[model samples]
Target: MRQPTLYLPHGAGPCFFMDWEPPDTWARHRAFLENLPATLPERPRALLVISAHWEAPQFTVQKHPAPPLVFDYSGFPPHTYQLTWPAPGAPLLAEQVAGLLQAAGLACGFDERRGFDHGVFVPLKLAFPEADIPCVQLSLRADLDPAAHLAAGKALMPLRDEGVLILGSGNSYHNMQVMLRAWQSGALTTHGLDFDAWLTETVTQADAVERERCLIAWSSAPGAREAAPREEHLIPLLVVAGAGGNAPGAKIFEDRVLGAVQSAFRFG
Candidate 1:
């Protein structure tokens, strides 16, 4: 069976492994990640993750045979740094990914040195705890162009049939400044909800052309700039949306975190 593409909310750095003041701040999101595999069609042969954490001049793929963890985040508990998922690297899949992009007329490159960043491991450590599946990490382009990333995803759609689970790891609402301000003020912010609602509607549209059109012009959506001052996190969704092709998207998960509404999406 073809695997579904996922756009998941990778919560604040190492949040799941630490104790929060509210104690249950990340509880629901953690549970969602832990239970994700059960919702999959089958065990994936490998995983292809497009993370917001890494961006290159061109789209890049991790080609390390045994990649290490990058420990990309800081200021977390010492135990969080010691955290390990130890999933093997999918070098062959990296090559396949590069080929797909090139064939689609998209620029592609390979990075043999870079390892899995927090964006790849933090959520996967909860979802695929066993760390048994081979995985490859892909980078978003530095340009953060939605249409280009979508095209890159469309090129890799064949991987789904080949048992490669394509995942886009990033939060739906990623404006730290806005989130921090709301959290400090002890007041709820509706910008996140406004953007999430528009995004959900755009992705779940029955008309693929309209969905793509809306996404391509996503900056115009309600609260778009407030929700995503920088587009890296939001860009991953476009790739997943593009890979979705004719299939309509579904909002699989949603939660209010740090005064912002974050969500996860799935497209078959």
Candidate 2:
């Protein structure tokens, strides 16, 4: 059976590992991630995550057999930096991913030293806490072009048939400055809500062709640029959307976080 492609929100740095004043603020998001494995049709042979935390000049694959934990976030509790998800690396899948990207005419590179960054480890830890699955990390392109990432994903679509879960790890609404302001004010921001609504409509309602077109030109969506001053977080959705092919996307998770609406999607 073909595995599902996911676009998940790896929430604010170390949110799951630590407690906040409002201890239950992240309860819904945490529950969604913790229950992710049960929602999958089956255990994937291996997992491939496109991490917003990593951006290279070209598409890069992590090929280390025993990848280290990358504590990419800062100013977290002392224990957070010491956190680890000891999942084994998927070198074979990494090479296959490289070949797929090359076949797509996208430049590909390999990094033997790179490890699982926050974007990959955080959500994976929540979903598969046992750390039994082999995982690989793919870096986002430094240019952050939606079409390029989408093409890359289209090339990797074959992996789904091979039981590899391809996931795009990013947040839906990722403007820290704006999100923080809304959090402090205890109110949701209109721009963030508008952008989130537009995104939901584009993926769940639009046909494949229109979805691709809107995503390629995503910056024009209401509150898009405001929601993501930098496109790294939003660009991952384009990749997953492309891999979706004719399969419909369902909004699997949606909630208000720090006064911004965040969502996740699954494509099969």
Candidate 3:
């Protein structure tokens, strides 16, 4: 079987599913998630998630057999905090990821105490609530550099061959504070959409070398800097691309934000 890896934009907050009105773009993603399981070519033995929510000075792997909750977000409905995503943790797979990092000339360790951050739980609850398949999560390195995250993903590439579904979860258009500000200032530009469009084209058309080059110099892309201010959300997609290495990306979902923000795409 061919190995498949994905870089998916996982938005913030669980309230995404509850919003029903226009200007609320997450509805598309929610519907997309509902269709996620049946769309898979095969059921994976395990899932390895690289969530933007989990960050560390060095890479950290979640290793508990029964990982706990990480209520990483704040200031929402009280029930949102109590939302349970009780998925079994994959300590063995987490070790393999750590070992891969070390073999690739990187420092790494385990975090048996770590819990499931919102990025993992939100997507998992929608995609695989059965909690039967083994799951593990890796943290983003401190630098948040594109090349570094891509390289880190390449290190974990072997997992795909071992029946592990590697997923790099983050958003494509992630300047939350900026976009919110642009809306408040009533001075929004086409820069973010322009950047998102350029990104989709590069991802769908470019070769591995060209794609890597674009990612490394991402700040120069049409709306690169504007799309991702901190780049934490954007970098995970690079890792997914690095892991897949020129494989065709089939966008299983696409949605425009309030007729403005270009927020969508999925790969396998």
Query: Which candidate ranks first by TM-score, i.e. highest?
Result: 1
Give the higher-TM-score candidate: 1 or 2. 1
Question: Best to worst by TM-score, what's the order?
Answer: 1, 2, 3
Write down the TM-score of every candidate: 0.98, 0.97, 0.90
Q: Model 1 off-target regions past 4 Å? A: none
Question: In angstroms, how far off is 92's CA in candidate 3?
Answer: 0.7
In every candidate, how many clashes are there? 0, 0, 1
User: lDDT per residue, candidate 3, 1-268, as tens digits?
Assistant: 4458877666666756454344455777777766776766688889888888878999888899998889888777787887887889988888889999899987888888998888888878888878788889898888887788878878887887788888878777777776556556666353367887787777776476776787778888886776777888877787777777656565556554423354444445
219: Cα error in model 2, Å:
0.1
Q: Runs in model 3 with CA error above 4 Å? A: 17-25, 179-191, 258-268
Name the runs in model 2 displaced over 4 angstroms: 188-191
Give the per-residue lDDT of model 1 (tens digit) for 131-245. 9999999999999998999899899999999999999999999999877787777776544888899999998999999999999999999999988999999999999988888
Whole-model lDDT, model 1: 0.93
Candidate 2, residue 83: how far the Cα is off, in Å: 1.0
Give residue 35's lDDT in candidate 1 (0 to 100).
97
